[model samples]
Target: MPEYGPQPVERQLPTEEARDLLDLVREMARREVRPTVDADEEAGRFPRDTFRQLSASGLLGLPYPSEYGGGDQPYEVYLQVLEELAHASLTVGLGTSVHTLSCHALAEFGSKEQRSARLPDMLGGGTLGAYCLSEPTSGSDAASLRTKARRDGDEWVIEGTKAWITHGGIADFYTVLARTGEAGPRGITAFLVPGDAPGLTFAAPERKMGMRGSPTAQVHFDGVRLPEHNRVGEEGQGFAIALSALASGRLGIAACAVGLAQAALDEALRYLHQRRQFGRPLADFQGLHFMVADMATQIEAGRSLLLTAARLRDSGRPFARQAAMAKLHCTDAAMRVTTDAVQLLGGYGYTTDFPLERHMREAKVLQIVEGTNQIQRLVIARDLLGPEEG
Candidate 1:
């Protein structure tokens, strides 16, 4: 497959500094992430040291303020770094992306005092964070969540279970969304919950088909007390905050999907040139050449969609709908591209001997997480027609 996108109409080309940063990140991924990912996935081991290294390299807070010890780069630059990281190791890329979403809640909605006190530690990479929004009964319909938080004198007592929490048990802090008033999106509020807060506990991590290196669990909040100051924004603003964060998050996932698809294409192309059948290289076979062509075409189309959405974000435009389209298209492309890559490898693809099978497994989760593709389509359609259509 050709494995490159058509020229983007709205390009987010890196500046000189951003390009340097990407080069450094790419070098690190090649040196550190590439070699260890296979073993880490097999053992389901989270690479704490690698995360620490990434933090020290200023990657953890790439787009945040420099005052908080971040690199303060643009989203365009930040996402490309994420792409390279994902191409080398999906686990690290996912963890980084989730952590970034967690930070986005605080950065965008936090009071000055809240940002000053918490952003330093969180953005500095000393404390990893997670966002708690999904519930057992509510995944896509997040506003229908039942988790409640009632004001009690000087504190709010939070009570309920948050499902599918990435870094549930291991994160140093959590950005929790809970129902604080009536019975819909308008009643929900966001709060910053410390990891050691009383009455907070984690269910055992769910064993998954892929992305096992990123821990996920259900978090129970039973009368967890938070000082009034911990609230992220005005009451009833949680849904907006979450939606905004997710818009950006969708772009991150789109970038990751493109990176994965590209990796699969590159691997397949290399193998085709080397692996032989019937006294000739596989690439020489006209039948397989057509298959490669399809894979490349899909990957490029995915890239075109993803970059278009990302540029909308960089240009400060309302991009939620575009982001949904990008996430849906790119992730679906990744699933197809990786699956075909595995098939190209024939019997060896089914084994753990190569990364194609692992990539295929990893691609499935991208379709599920962030938002399911079904939800993404709904989001796009609602925006295209009108909010009343929702």
Candidate 2:
């Protein structure tokens, strides 16, 4: 095994108060989330009660302003809490992260009246949200979306379909992006559509290989009517808002990926110490020890990158490139770490008896969602080389 050096120092450490918050979050994860995760995943159960508990604990609105019943925690602290939740269950972790991203439109760009009317229910309790951006024809190329929103007097009638919405049918609200102008990305606009809107409907949840507990569906808006006040930001600004929201959402996914990797590493380490082979502990073998070392090193590096991007966000610095880099690196690291975890577990890792298989499955989706790793690379390259070349 390679001789490991001291772990790199964290540029910013959690304060005592932040540590206490993390403890509370970890306690919730261990007590309420961890035990139920496998069963829930197997049964395809959505943990509405878990989210309600999170809301009550003031976790649902972490990083938002306290005036709106949020914890007003920094993004760095908020991401750590998300990491803890994800270490327990990727379903809940990803769902919460998506919900937070859905709220960004209203919180950052909605009119005062819109915020007053909508944010309390979303940020407080009893309401979950979904962000609607991707369409069947356009996943990576959001500029090519075909969903239409037409203005008529005081109402905008939305007619389109959104694919892969995380909380499609179950959410209380949706932040929908629709085409409202000429063509391409500039035509897009966002609207806050109630789940119970008359013309809104959903397909059955997708049957996926992982994160089965969290619902994913196709949301159809067949002339869904919304008042003009529901529009979030200026019409052309929707794409910008969506991009901004996604930049942050990518960080959330990165944090969740790291958490998943950590969970896998912990499980493998525990099993390695206990599972004897060839008259010795599995951890004693040189080859396995080297693998374990690599997993730990990758996790620490992912954590460093995630926190760096989060701190940049909290400081109100330009961090789109950093966020993309973190998301790409962390999720890629997760895929590698989780795969090795299964390898370490031997036959048990391939079976549903252990959580490593599920972690591996969940890690795959993190690489694809909130902007694919390819897209992240593009974002980074654009940042470094300037958009004229892009």
Candidate 3:
């Protein structure tokens, strides 16, 4: 562990307000998140209080409109805020991203009435959210989900299971994607299901290598009913809405990856400067110096890619390809940098004595989530080369 803790990141913010936001976030991270991270992560304790605090501070809905309790901040600023949160504790960071993703379909496509009635509570009323898309048999092939939602008069009866739900049982609301019509992607539609909805249940959280404090569980909807107004977007628009949310969601993952990698790099540098070997500090070694340089370079490159994609999104431009690229590059770089940090620390890094091992484990999930790196490559190639001819 670094004696001074992780250093503050130097940011190129868009405005004075944004800068103040970052400063406030750093203070929260330092005061609320970093101190208890090790203990909570070790115990697999979810930081529900921290999330409530984030909601109270207006941090939960930074990128959404202020009209609905959001901060009205741009994506660029929001992603940076995610990075800082991740740097302090990945559970907080990734949880914030997932919560934001859960709000997307409603915020973007729901009717004005829906927005007026639901958005305020979802955005900042201390309610946590989960996005339900992938099912037991559907991961990367999300369009092939088997979840069914049949209409009965004005209500939709949802019967299906959602796998890998981040907030699962604990979420106050869930933005769920379920089949409502024919089959495949077009048949799918989104719904905002209340957490206390009858017939809704959650499996126990999955045991994972890292980010254990953030629960990941299977959400089961056994004929849960929702009113007609609960549907988000059109009856056959769920897949489109999911894809749109994921495009921006990928950038959130990228920012979190960069933040995790930066944390690793900070730890490694701290170790290098303090740990002495053969009558000299580890920092004096040329080999370790190059490693640090490479780690810093990768972090910078990842930050630039994600920020570029975020700015493009903020400007109302097409950024799906850039988001994929950023997700792929940044997660891969986090994997590399975190592993390198472990190597720099030798046996200490591999053990729970240092955070590097946790960083390494956490970085692996980033590469796989929000679409795997393989999926990202396919997405980027599709953007450039179009669909496969066969």
Candidate 4:
């Protein structure tokens, strides 16, 4: 019998270099991530070595400036890379997205001196980073975050807890948002806090339904201090910085969703052809293959939506609306496809012996993270209607 697995996605690339890069990423995913994802996820083991390998391969900073040790690829190419990684394993894919998000504030808003001093190591020197924006009390309402940074001569004292932080306890650095001026968005400021800072601490990772290998925990800054030079952009500018990062990050989530949906679809197709019912293969049934067709169509649609948004971002066009749409559609599609995949696989799908159940559980989080689907709808509405009238 022939083997059944995820085949390569046919992609249209802007250059031969981009095509080669995708090939490298696909090979890495097949060799390094797919084989052990099940065991590692079951064990709740974070793939630190895999991440180091990604960093060494220059994948950690694909969308940033080449002068700073980034790959300098456009978001178009970068997001496709994320999609392929996600097709292999969501933990790896989503982890990479969070790491890229963590670097956004500094890469886009930091001083040239700061970028020169820190970007090389962060981009490719095996360093991992976490983004800190949501507090224990504020998640979607990010502007209301309560973490504070008070100035004390040359150093700033930070005190508060950031909840739902990816790589919370294990990252090498943190891109933190803190209240530095008044209340609300205007008061917020961004800082680069070394993960080993004296007063920084983390709660145990959250036990979740899926993506177990990616740590999500609360990070506490108990009088953590940092020099004035660590500030990114300007004081009272963190909210804008965070929002900007999220627009791009939503595209990352969208790509991940498409990848995951594709994975589930691939598995469903493989099983259908191999499993027989009513004296014939399940795939021979018109109704069943029609379901598979819907799944593939959704995945393709999601992929196109994300790539369109990515190209918009790369071209300096406004993409927040499109990003929100992509995130909403792709994640919702993943949920539907994965659930249908389970139905197709029947009893076997519900068991740990198959990956369908895991895919279903993992798909649920994409709807919740990067702003909940409800939040995405609100964002889309706001863009369509202009800000809510007072």
Model 4 alpha-carbon drift over 4 Å, by segment: 1-7
- lDDT tens digits by residue: candidate 1, 1-390: 754322222334567887677778889998999999999989998888888888788888987898867787877778778888888988898888998999998898998888888898888756789999999999998889999999999999999999999999999999999999899889999999999999999999999999888899999998999999999999989999999999999988988888888788888888888898999988889998888899888877877777777777878898899889989998999999999999999998889988999999999999989999999999998888877722
Model 4 agreement with the true structure over 1-390: per-residue lDDT tens digits: 765544667896899999999999999999999999999999999999999999999999999999999999999999999999999999999999999999999999999999999999999999999999988899999999999999999999999999999999999999999999988899999999999999999999999999999999999999999999899998899999999999999999999999899999898888988898889988789888688889888998988998999889989999999999999999999999999999999999999999999999999999999899999999999999999878
| TM-scores for the candidates | 0.95, 0.96, 0.98, 0.98
Model 2 residue runs over 4 Å out of place are 1-13, 388-390
Cα error of candidate 2 at position 306, Å: 0.8
lDDT of 2 at 218: 98
TM-score of 2: 0.96
Q: List the residue pairs that clash in candidate 4.
A: none
List, residue by residue over 92-177, the lDDT tens digit for candidate 3: 99999999999999999999999999999998999999999888999999999999999999899999899999998999999999
